[model samples]
Target: MPDLVIALDVGGSSVKSGVVQADHTVYQRRTTPIDSSGPAESILATLAAIIDGHARTLGKDAVLRGVGLGFPGPFDYAQGVCYIHGVAKYEALYGLHMDAELRARLAWGPKPPIRFRNDAEAAIIGEFCYGAGRSFVRGIGVTLGTGFGSTFVVEGKPQRAGPGVPPNGWLYAESWQGQQADDVFSARGLQARLAAAFGRPLDIPTAAQRARVGDQQLQEVFRRFGADLGAFLYPYARAFDAHVVLILGGIAHAMDLFETAVAQALRLPVRGGALGPDAALLGAAELFFA
Candidate 1:
């Protein structure tokens, strides 16, 4: 019988999961909506259902290896406890022992081990092992979405501290143009720029659509964003002696608009994620495999 593991990438809006074989083949990928603002019990039930569903699909003959999750922070990944407060998501789970709570709700005869890692860190590791960062010995993985997420990797291992790495290996809290890096380099930041340009509120998706049709003003917004992001990453890249920069997340889909600016500013190889949304899922599986 083949051993199977469940890998999950838990976000504020949804949970992405997959079943993995021992050889790292991922299948049965699913995205389920979740209300992170709901009660802790509800959240746990949702997660349990996902796990149970996957377990059943594998049938009685399959060996349940373990479960792994890539979750957001500020969390105790080592302890499987939630400390994410004042973040407007998962507040109900604060201080709760997630691993225990989840185990209690599961129906497995012998509950498999559950492990966790920071989502951003997991995504980077996924890319390092199988995607863009595989070609580089040292690299930075940046996810540009609702917020800015980052991780530094050296020789396929995540580095939280060292020369050129910021506190916690996070770039979101860093100052950029008198504001936090997240305030200037995220989806909201792009929307804000678009709004300022047109003197009206604009969403990122709409702006991206316009830019694709040769809207010069909208195109300029993305270009500026790229330049700013490049400037923001420059010092750290130099300090860490990184060989490449891998961009992931929803915003990365607009790379064509800003790729040149980022390359020109950073003077390093900049590439978009090759694995798309699967990077984090595979990264989560690494907890069991690695």
Candidate 2:
């Protein structure tokens, strides 16, 4: 019988789940929209349904191995408890013991082990194990999207403290130029710069499109963002003696727009993630495999 694990990347607005084989290939995958702000029970029910659906798809002889999740913070990944509040998402889950709730709802013959990891950490782990960071011994992964997410990895394991890593290995709370790194490096940051430049707010996708079409002003905005990102990462990269940096998330799609500036400033190899959204799911599965 084949052994398969269910892996999930839980986000504020959606959940990406997959059935992964021992070889790290996803046999089946799904992305489900979630109203994270909804009632806790409703959200839990949705998650249960997703899991049950995947379980039903397995062949009769397949053995369920475990369930793994990549969730955002402030969460207790080790305990499967949620402390996320005031984030406009997953508020109803505050103080909830997710592992117990999930276990109670599963219909499998024997409950599978359930584990969780920080979403950013999971992404980096996926990269380290299977994607762009596969060749490096130590590196940093940055996910630039609705917010700035970061993690440090050594030998395929996520590290929270050491030389060059900020408290909790997170850069979002760190200050750069009197502003939180999240405020300066996220999608909102790009929009803020674009708004300041054109006297109106412009979304990242629109800005990228314009920049690609020879909109010099928009192009400059991305370049400046890249330069600033590089400047911010320089100290940490040097401190950690990082060998490489892997960029992930929606913003990474536009890396070409700013790759030059980041490379020039950081003076290190910067590469985009090769796994796309699957990185987190694969990384989540690693909680059990590792």
Candidate 3:
């Protein structure tokens, strides 16, 4: 093990990079919104710059032990390739060799070993190692951000299930069962919910504030969000039998707004994710060392 590690969590909205110590402490963290033309080439340039920037900060003798990158799209981690889901704009990376690319990009200055996983997987790692995941083995991690990204954790182990869709067989579920994961259980979905209900623009903070003050429309909107969350989570409980779904990210933290309906849906088989704020940052370093 080296003295220093750099973990890069690449998200749809932002890219966060930070340095971690052997004792699992995080310092000198930096984040920038993901700004690119949504093409593989452009995104690659952006990512490469972030990586280099972090490496430059760790100093010459710190001994870079490893680098871990979490991408937003479905990925084949075994292949070290990321499949851009039209949103990332990198059709060429579908099976592109990442080890080689990373080596080529940061071949200079005592390169530490590198590892890659889905951004969801990385967040789960964050939860399991040091955040909400510290409690149970059978917890599912869900980041309710721009998109809903989830990982199934069994006894502190996150599924390496890449970007490939699972055999959960959701077609009939969607038609008859009601809510789906990405549509109803995401931040973007929350925004859409407020928009659809009010027939006007509804920012995240504004809606939360009005609802706090007993705004009927906003309260209804939040209640509806809770209901949809319960509906979406029902299937996860049935399919994976997850003990707790460790909630992280911007939307998940605002659990107060949707606690009524969301918690109401928690029955015998399912429960809420207890990982509080800073799960992602904690996981960023913990995943690397673990």
Candidate 4:
């Protein structure tokens, strides 16, 4: 196995890339927010620059095995195609052959293979391999960030999209509380809910801060978030027969506010992400080994 690989976790808000060792140590990590509103060519150019810059920094002596990428869906991983049309973000990637575009811009000796998977799937794989899900044979991973990301894994492999898993193995579009899960479980959802309840604009951090200070309204928001999360995952947990459900990403930091509700709603074990955001990058790299 190669000692190092370039890994990228592409989210709706930002793209995180790094050179990661087999043991999960990261080097030369870089993160930048993506402009989903920008022109498609510009987005592609930004991605190209990052990949080229990383490859150059790794130097000619670096023996990189391949590049592994975890990106949002819906996408065609086999053909390196993106289908993010009408989504909240990354819509410019729609119908683009992203893998070829990146590879064309990467100037490295002996072009390496590039593997792609849904960001949620990669995150879960990372969790199973090195985080809270490590001990469980059946696990479900959810990343509550710009959007809801989800995947089911069993015995170290991700389950394909099916009856229980939903389309493209994504939980974001799942129906919940008479609306889509994406409408209730994402960063936008949190902010929107806060605005409606408090009659003002409130970002996630401010809401969390207020909750910490015993602000009842803010506290209720998080509690509702927790309750909704629990309600959303209840069926999935039953379907996957999950031993543990790992919650990850920016929203996870407020677990103290909503942990009780989530725990009560979930029958199985539930925990915050042990590896945090790095889990997806690490998991993306693992694809090379697999």
Candidate 5:
């Protein structure tokens, strides 16, 4: 029987879970809401259910080895404590011993090691080992979603954030055009830019649709965003000696509008993620194996 792990990729909007084998093959997968607005315990319960539901599918022969999870941070990844506060997302989870509580709720027959990593970190590892980054020995990954998430990896190990890379491998805090990168690189940021340009608000999906139809304003927004992304990553990539970049997250679906600009500005190969959206889930499982 193959060794298996229950893995989760927790995002601001949803939780993606799966039973995965050591070779990065998923046996079963599921997704549920994160319910960030709910009580902290409720959010933990949702994660527990997702893990339990998937583990049950393994049956008696399954050699369950561990549980792995990847989620947003500004939190203590080592301590499993949530520190993301006053941001209207996961704020209810502050000061909670998130890892211990999650372990207590999960009903595995024999408890396994539970490990956590910043969601973007896990996603990049997944890409490095199994996706568009597999061909590269050194690379960077950027996930365009609620925030501008990024990671730098070399020889299959994640590089820590330093002089050029901001904290936790994130590039959102860097200064650009006299403004913080977060002010121009996220979902809300894009919408705000669109509102300022078009005199109306447009949601991310709608804005992406508009960009696809030759809406010059929207197209320019993404183009600029892509260019900003390239500018933000240039120094970090050079510092890390990254050879390729893998773009992930829901925003990657609209790469057609911005990829060229990103590639042109970065002067490196930029490609959409190849693992679909499950890269984080697989990477979470890899944490145990690592």
Candidate 6:
């Protein structure tokens, strides 16, 4: 029988889950809201139901070893306890026994082997085995979403860092987001810039178009965005000595226009993420497969 594992990446807005073979090739994937208002028990129950729905399709004979989970916030990998939970502005999980209920509802067997990992760290594991971080001993991934986030791989495994810094990786410094990075570079930052500069909301393609056509203001805006990220990311690059740094997200995807400014500002070399949206899904697989 082909061995199978169910994995879920719990994020602030949504939960990304999938089933993968032992080799970590994803066979199925799904996403849903991270509903937390209905008590942690309800959350776990829904999660189990979600997993079971996928499990039935994998077949009963498929040797479904267990489900691996990635939760945002601080976690005690050894103790399986939720510590300082703050992924999406939710406070219900602060002292919750996230693992216990996850096991009870999500892992349903006498010998169930549910494994949990830090969200960002798990991303690194997935990237290493099934995504872009494969060859580099030092792999770093930044999730540039509502916030700038990151994770690292050292010696072919997740290297943990942080109890703070708003979840952005590579550069956790307040300067990266709350202060400068996002304040001047992210999607929201760009929106504000356009509203201020053009007196309206403008998309990237349009902004890039204008910039390419020699629109000085638009060009400078994107340039400043890159420069800020570069400056914020340089210290971490130097500290971790990572050869490949991946920038993942809508903002990071458009690296061509802003990358130079960011690189020049930080005086470091960072590249676009190799995996795209698959990083989180693959990271879910790493929970059990790794």
Per-candidate TM-score against the hidden true structure: 0.96, 0.97, 0.81, 0.89, 0.92, 0.79
Q: Among all windows of ten consecutive residues in candidate 3, which has the lowest summed lDDT?
A: 167-176
Cα lDDT tens digits for candidate 2, 162-233 = 999998899999999999999999988888999998788788888899999999988999999999999999
lDDT for residue 231 in candidate 5, whole number 0-100: 80
**Selected candidate, larger TM-score, 2 vs 3:** 2
Prediction 4 global C-alpha lDDT: 0.82
TM value for model 1? 0.96
lDDT of 5 by residue, 1-87 (tens): 888888888877788888888887886777787788788988989888887788777779888888888977877888888888888
The residue pairs found clashing in candidate 2 are none
Candidate 3: misplaced stretches above 4 Å?
A: 38-42, 59-61, 88-95, 160-179, 238-241, 268-278, 281-288
- lDDT per residue for candidate 3 within 193-222, as digits (tens), equals 889877887888888888888889888888
Candidate 3 positional error at 10, Å: 1.1
Instruction: Name the lDDT value of residue 133 in candidate 5.
Output: 90
Q: Clashing pairs in model 1?
A: none
Clashing pairs in 6: 148-168, 149-168, 149-169, 150-169, 226-262, 227-262
What tens-digit string does per-residue lDDT give for candidate 4 at 1-290? Answer: 43788888886667899988877787888897777668888787777776777888776566788889998778898788999888667787788888787777666656677889888778889888888888999878888887788888887688876546776567887788788888889899888999999998988988899899999988998998898898789888887678888888788888899888887898777888888677888899988866
lDDT (Cα atoms) of all candidates against the true structure: 0.89, 0.90, 0.65, 0.82, 0.81, 0.67
Error at 178, model 4, angstroms: 1.1
lDDT of 1: 0.89
In angstroms, the error of model 1 at 283 is: 0.5
